[model samples]
Target chain A: MSDDELARKQRRRRNIAIGLGVAGFVLIVYLVTILRMQANLAAGP
Target chain B: MRHKPGMRQPVAISSMSAPDVAGPQDYFDLLKPRVMSLVVFTAAVGMVAAVADGARVPFGLALASLFAIAVGAGASGALNMWWDADIDSVMARTVGRPVPRGVVPRAEAAAFGGFLSALSVALLALSSNYVAAALLAFTIFFYLVIYSMWLKRSTPQNIVIGGAAGALPPVVAWAAVTGTAPVEAWILFAIIFLWTPPHFWALALYRDGDYARAGVPMMPNVAGRAATKRQIFAYSVVLAVAGLAPYFVGMAGPFYLAVAAALGGVFVYLAFKTLRSGDEDKASAKQLFAFSIIHLFAIFAAVLIEDLVALHV
Candidate 1:
């Protein structure tokens, strides 16, 4: 690949990695919220 | 060197660089220190009240838990600045904020928020009950995700509902010592929750143009000034009643009852003034906005003072 093409490909990969990282972070948050709500419900008044 | 027909230009690297070199004050601004101060004070009140009520929280652990809660509040502020930089840039009141001025990079703000979030929750868990730590974590998540990302852009009721996150600090502090939230703690929560709408809507009334320019769906922008004023009045009335609830519930004494009644009366009066005043001047709106802050702080201070006085008597 030409130098410019290689740089473009590298940028694409970085963007994809960032996107996946955000997705994973969001997944963890969702799981935590779900667990807390369940626990609060179980300990209900 | 022909480009594809539909290709978009890549973002310039220099454009992504921090726009202005920030001083220490910029970092302080990132915390929204005024708002954080209220969170810290109210949380501390909750902690002291819990202890006064016969909960035996160790001094060291309580101090650590308070610090963690403060950091959590700061983290939420930072994340808010990060997400709302665009809107902040356009609003006169928020134009000088660190992120909007580019004194802080958005990514750095996000990373700072994430780091503080993790540290706060971990420290809370280690020093206090896991339930408190978990509540703190959820508060951060609710403010940053639900309030900032979703509700803020989607609806005018954002502040009304999102206020729950701010209201949770006292409950979390109570749980830190007692290992559970009680009816009294939630009454405190409800007071703050109901108080938020009138407080925020007053500011929204004055900053309606800014919100409209920034495309934020603040009540005044989406629902018109008259409707927003009426809602503010309604919420102020509800908040006044809720503020008086602690005294009725036997959680507070005569001093608290007197202070709450006086403040709530003034607040409702201010709300009514704002409703009656012409939208052209905006003076009443501004007055109500300033008084709302004092109203909340004074009420909390009264609670602390009343509790101490009751103990002495």
Candidate 2:
């Protein structure tokens, strides 16, 4: 592949990695929130 | 140069060039995964000890805090490698590191480290208390800026005080659970802090040429091997005392006390052996280096087991 092609490919991979990392972080936050709410509900005052 | 027997031979790299492609493993290596694992284990032990000491934190939150602490540790490692790439390139032991070997560019490594440092600290703050996050931030700054950038090149006592960065994980972990570090947490920090000199000085005694060639003023490189050996023995004695602090302070139980005493005795024995050996005895230093890792692991493992048993009772 051409140098420009390689650069574009690298950029695409970088964007994909960033997208996945952000998504994973969001998922962790969501899971933690749900788990915490579940615990509170189970406690039932 | 004639190295002592049983030393691992470093690959003779005559030339260095950038790879055509930087793979996932290269990036992962940038994190210094082995060092990260040790940090994670010690931080986890600290967190578990805090829980045993009556700090209430949700399991999920604790897990998240541990993750962030591990990342923060890795971030420091990456930043260290990035900043030390120049010297790392010259040192035989570090010549094959990702940046020095051109698997990862210095700029990319620095940016990666910077990004991870921010992300880890922010994640910690969101998951746990701001105190833990702030401590983690300080750890990254202290390791990268203070230790790696400044003291490493300037002082023979670089690892002496710079060890504070490594020793802070337990304190940060304790603060994550309690939102404040009690004396017990600081005791754990003290054990690791005192333990650091002997642990590293042993390695430095053997790798004296690397520090000299790289222009990094390690204790052995600056103060001579005999002085470094004496200092290592001195630190080991204090470390042995600090190792018993968990039991004396009532943070750890009798089970941990017994294990700590045994391991601390062995550590002192090894350090003494390193000190008493002839200048040519790289073997003693290597033994101390190897056993120092085992001592830390066993002490922390004992603490975790004791804490778990307490919870069961």
Candidate 3:
């Protein structure tokens, strides 16, 4: 493969990694929010 | 070629050309994953210890907080790499790190670190208690601003004082679980803080040339080898004593006490061996350096096992 081709491939991989990382972060936030809400709700007003 | 703080120095380049491919792995390397692993282990032990002590935290929350803590640690590692890039290039042990090797730019490292620092702290607050988040923030700041940027280049006592940052993860983990870091958590903290000096000074003893060439003032470099040996032995003695505090404080049972005493004895003996070895001998230093890692790991593992047993049974 050409140098430019290798560079483009690397960039694509990096973007994919970033996308996955962001998705993972969002999932964690959602889970945490649900968990915290459950705990607070279980505690009552 | 001493790296003066606030002075710009050129990075020491390897004879090999910088890799044109800057991949995700290079960015991951910026996190100092090995160090992050230790942080994760110690912090997990802290969380388990808190649970054993009657702290009621959800498993999911605990897991999330641990992730944030790991990210916070990685952020600090990235910032340290950013600030120490110049000296890192000089040191044989660190010459291949991402920034120094030119796979990652220094500014990018700084930005990455800063972003992760904020993200980790904010995520921790959302996932855990404010106390844990605050401690995480302080750990990052202490490692980056206080240790990496300032004390690392300035004094021989750098590791001794800077050890606090490395030791805080467990305390932060305890706070995440309990929302309070009581004496039990502090006992864990104390064990790691004391363990730091001897562990690092042992490495410094053997790697004196790397540190000297890099112009970093490690204990062996700033103080003579004999003095550094003495200090290591002294800290080892104290560390041995501190290692027993968990049992006394009721954090662990007799099993932990037995394991801690046995490990601490060997640690002190190794430190003593390193002390008694000829000035030119690197063998003992190398042994002590390698054993110190196992020593700390075994002690914490013992505590973690005992805590798990207590929590379950």
True contacts kept of each: 0.00, 0.08, 0.68
Best by DockQ: 3
lDDT of 2 by residue, B108-177 (tens): 9999999999999988887787999999999999998889887877889999999999999999999988
Task: Give the clashing residue pairs of candidate 2, or none.
Answer: none
| Candidate 1, B187-264: lDDT as tens digits | 889989999999988998887877776677899888989999999999999999999998898888788999999999
- The parts of candidate 3 lying over 4 Å away from their true place are B5-8, B12-19
Model 2 lDDT per residue over A1-45, tens place: 775676567667767776887899888878767766776787898
List TM-score (chain A only) for every prediction.
0.80, 0.84, 0.91
The TM-score values for the models, in the order shown, are 0.81, 0.89, 0.97
Clashing pairs in 3: none
User: Each model's interface RMSD (Å)?
Assistant: 11.4, 3.8, 2.1
The ten-residue window of minimal lDDT in model 1 chain A covers: A27-36
Please compute DockQ, using alpha carbons, for every candidate against the native two-chain complex: 0.03, 0.24, 0.66
Of the candidates numbered 1 and 3, which has the greater lDDT value? Answer: 3
DockQ of 2: 0.24
